[model samples]
Target: MDWRTKLLNPKQKARQDYKSLVTPVYRGSTVVFDEQSLIKDDWKQSENGYSYGLYGTPTALELGARICDIEGAKHTFIVPGGQSAIALVYFAFCKSGSHALVPHSAYGPNKAMAEGLLRDLGIEVESYDPLIGKDIKKLIRKNTSLIWCESPGSVTMEIQDVPAIVKAAHEKGVPVALDNTYAAGVLFDAFKYGVDVSIQALTKYIGGHSDILLGSVSVRDDSVYNVIGSIYMQLGLAVSPDDCSLALRGLQTLAIRLEQLEKATFQIALKLSEIDIIENVYHPALTSCPGHEIWKRDFTGSASVFSFTFAKKISGDQVEKFINSLNIFKIGLSWGGVTSLAVVYPDLVRPNKDFEGRLVRLNIGLEATNDLINDLEIAISKIN
Candidate 1:
């Protein structure tokens, strides 16, 4: 080797194979080819070859493979965040002059995307009742291209009829996209239920902590992959290898953590149901949740997130007192972390503001069940 070439600090001649229990972290924008003559563009085929960092790296691919294994999917794409994964699906399927029927209770940002970018691009975004099942057939348009479902719709917690909706959409030759984040792709089987594209916000459960942000797109068919993958490549969607590594670490303990989260969340939901301060507990496992029967039939289990409203009429000041009285259960947003959180939806997420009463959402975390229950009881006592 020439002295000048050997002087580079980043280049090294020492050889050592990396062997470990975790996936190796690869951070590189440019992949080195064996020889100048062997360079080609197929590297973006993450499943088949080493690709550009924007498409995926070894670290990203490992996480994608892990998600695919859990979801029983043919292919998976790692994206920046859950909302971006949703956007990627939208770009892949919907075209100019096409229309989509979304649940009225979809994640607010997704609804905003439909009304913002998709609408400006000539796609019509419409909202359907979350409880609509086979009846969704009546709303299918000749130009309909996509249908969206979020089981146990965002904050309100109205469980959707996924199977019935999927059947109807498939009959009309349209694709269904689901925000399976609440299920963490664990409670619900997206592909088995006939969903074409399943998106998960790894930030919530797969990350298992509030530390990193990540998302994934799991496809059931090769045809669907080609469509989405094309858009994915063109859009230049990429994620941090460091974040992917963190999620991979989270997977090692996912099963146990999910089990605990399910148990603790259900216990808290049950306790809240009996409390006089709460009128309706909107948990999928609870009978009061819309389409609970459907959830019982389809979902394997529930997650850590749910919502409720106050029973007795109370002023805004009383609600504030309730919030301030809590020792644990800090006021915050997002969920599925080791720390408990609570949020109040005074304006609600949607602009329509259809929901009434004092709507409060809780994300049960890894804490003693009795401690969480007591924290809630103390908070409610101030308002009650």
Candidate 2:
């Protein structure tokens, strides 16, 4: 009934002569059925029965089951990457001429997909402020079909009032999808907070080792699952068996790794907040964080990713100099891996008229907190 029992039972079923404790990576395109009748029966419902490797394998199914347990969902669909998972949600839910709403501070690529591709497809997308809370009601239209959200909006780290949004969306018969890659369900359970579809980039925290690229969408409602799964099959987007194996291995350590990372990050963010050069620390766990109340009320814990802003006295080039001085923190885009990463604010952020601070995103890894703090201090000292 609990996660441990479910995970352990699946391991028992995993081992046969051909299968092992960790389901042997099933790599093949064709799946030979017992007979034509069986094949036809399987084709009717690809998710329940395997017609081909592309549909899914026993290996992928085992991992999917595990994810479904963690997410508390009736069904889950695995995709190639986080972005692809997001795309699938839109494709499945949004029809031409329908409008979708996304948070203004969502991931840049997600915004681009809405503004460029979805816009081209004639789906209207309006970006609302992440801090809008219950005010999101005013933005909903008669044609609105989907409302997408990302808690602690990727760049500015403003945690949205998810419950408020979910309630408002459902009243108008709209489903809410959350880009939960940042929280990764380890900290927050989207289902408990009224989210219909919980989207995650298994490439990040789920694939904590960063060895494979995978994405997942966990749906609590059966009707939502059927629609998304139909789109998944139509789109031909399924994760490979080997990638699923790697992600399964990564999930086992996710709880421990995330706890350590969260603790270290809080310490680091607290120290960063004290630095005279930083105007604000955007970690939701800290009291100084703008969305601390919402985060405290909604989230179970925190993730390693957090952001901070530079004081106005610091120039963009000075910020770059500080980032360049870091010895341990690597300059990179992706996060939730074992290694810590840092991305300069100007490189990733486009200055918006609404936001005031120069943002620097940090992905704290499983590193010694003292060493990381020392490295950050040296980097911060160079910014002036």
Identify the leading candidate in terms of lDDT.
1
TM-scores for all candidates: the values are: 0.95, 0.92
lDDT of 1 by residue, 194-218 (tens): 9999999999999988999999999
Clashes of 2: 0
Per-model tally of clashing residue pairs = 1, 0
In model 1, the Cα lDDT at residue 24 comes to: 81
Error of 1 at 314 (Å): 2.1
Q: Across residues 1-384, which tens digit of lDDT does each residue of candidate 2 receive?
A: 788898856645644576446667778778777777766433224345677666677667777788889989888777888999999999999989999999878888899999999999999999998888988889999999999999988867889999999999999989999999988865788999999999999999999977899999889888998888878878888678889999989988998998898899999999998888788888999876767899999998999899888887877778888888999999998899998899865755433643233678899998899999999998887766
Worst 10 residues of 1 by lDDT: 348-357
- Model 1: lDDT equals 0.89
